[model samples]
Target: MDGAVIGLIGTVVGAVSGVLGTLITIRLGGAEQRRTQNDQSERQGRSSAYSALVTACSRTYRVGYAAHATLQAEGHQQSPNDAETLEEFRSAVEEALEAVSVVKLHGPNGIACAADNLASAMSGWRSEVELLADGRGDDQRASEAIELYEELEDRFIALGRETLSGVPARP
Candidate 1:
């Protein structure tokens, strides 16, 4: 209980407390850094998925529009390349549908819903084109279908932008 002994005990306690604090700080900092990195990675994945969906949808729309226009102009004539065009349009739609799957996997529900809407729009357009080829639809109907698809596509793009930019979706 001499002054030197008391001082030594006090110094030891202080050193132990300082080490524990440093360890705790380091652990917490590491956890925070890891959490941030994970968030960033998830965002990147979602961005990629959204971009892919957009690209796929665009391609499908273009192919479908072209096919529909050709069918309207040719009046059901079985041109040699008509088969090829049909195949291309089908492939594009399949790709877009697959991209929608990717978006769903990386989704926050809102973007996924938008993606689904776009996909449905594309399918509707494709159906209109099929009806056109079958003489069940006219040019005006094809045009309307395209318009609907474009509107849905714009919605999807807007939602993707908001999601990627960290803006919350409006309810």
Candidate 2:
């Protein structure tokens, strides 16, 4: 009887150990899967945000450039039909602002700051164009605004590429 009881005890211990090991493995696997899923979701979000910002900036730049060229050609002669062109430019600026806001929400601080600088440059450029349309501003201010906008746009694109590539951002 003593031997039989010892044998039963050994069997029970083996079963419990096996069960515990399996449970631990399953739990660990589930945790790892969750972590992978979360990482993928984060990457997708960042990608989407970066794409939106880039597209918005490109569209805005195109529209703004056209408006600037038109204004330059007009040269201190405000036409009655200029209102339509100015309105289109304003709409483009608003769209770019909206995109910048999204970038700020999803991107890191450095990228967001670059976006902000770009937006500010856009505003300055728009103001310069408006002044030109009113026959009150010189070409120098408009040129300066364009240069600043280009610089900021380059910075923003660099930061965005670094972010998407998983590279550490530069100071």
Candidate 3:
């Protein structure tokens, strides 16, 4: 081939190679960006769900403690407002249950387990409060239930913090 024809062929090949390289780079960069955004969104969701679960647990614990205190003060007698108090406690428990489900959905397994433990502890505390109000339980039982619930709640909080900080969950 003549020099001009050879030079033309070389230029065309070089141009095609540059275009392909640019296209591939753009495509890979876009994919990486999308992956990063998805990771960030999921992290935010988990954070919000964990926070809600903790708040619900706190409310339930407070209500249970109050009910226990009221029963203690009245010598286990069912007061006129005992029904109302029990109803309020039940509502708090229900809210906590819903929050647990959310945490389970957004969980890395370990956090879900912690949330489940806390919910169970809260339920047990409620049962103790009921027994005390009905004169079937003593102060010690109520106190023990409260202590267990508090411990489980603390565990959940710690696990949630670790999970949010990108730590792998402990079995």
Give TM per candidate.
0.90, 0.87, 0.91
Judged by whole-model lDDT over C-alpha atoms, candidate 2 comes out at 0.84
Model 2, 90-121: lDDT tens per residue?
88888888988988998688888988998999
Give lDDT tens digits, candidate 3, residues 37-118: 9999999999999999989887887887788789888445677799889889989999999999999999889989999898
Q: How close to the true structure is residue 15 of candidate 3, measured as C-alpha lDDT? A: 100
Best by lDDT: 3
Cα displacement (angstroms), candidate 1, residue 169, comes to 8.5
Encode model 1's per-residue lDDT on 97-118: one tens digit a residue: 9999999999889888988888
TM-score: which is higher, 2 or 3? Answer: 3
Distance (Å) between predicted and true CA of 161, model 2?
A: 1.1
Please list the residue runs of candidate 1 whose C-alpha ends up more than 4 Å from where it truly belongs after superposition.
74-76, 168-171
At residue 99, give the lDDT of candidate 2.
86
How many backbone collisions does model 2 have? 0
Q: Which candidate, 1 or 2, would have the higher lDDT against the true structure?
A: 1
- Each model's lDDT comes to 0.86, 0.84, 0.89
In model 2, what is the error at residue 157, expressed in angstroms? 1.2
TM-score of 1: 0.90
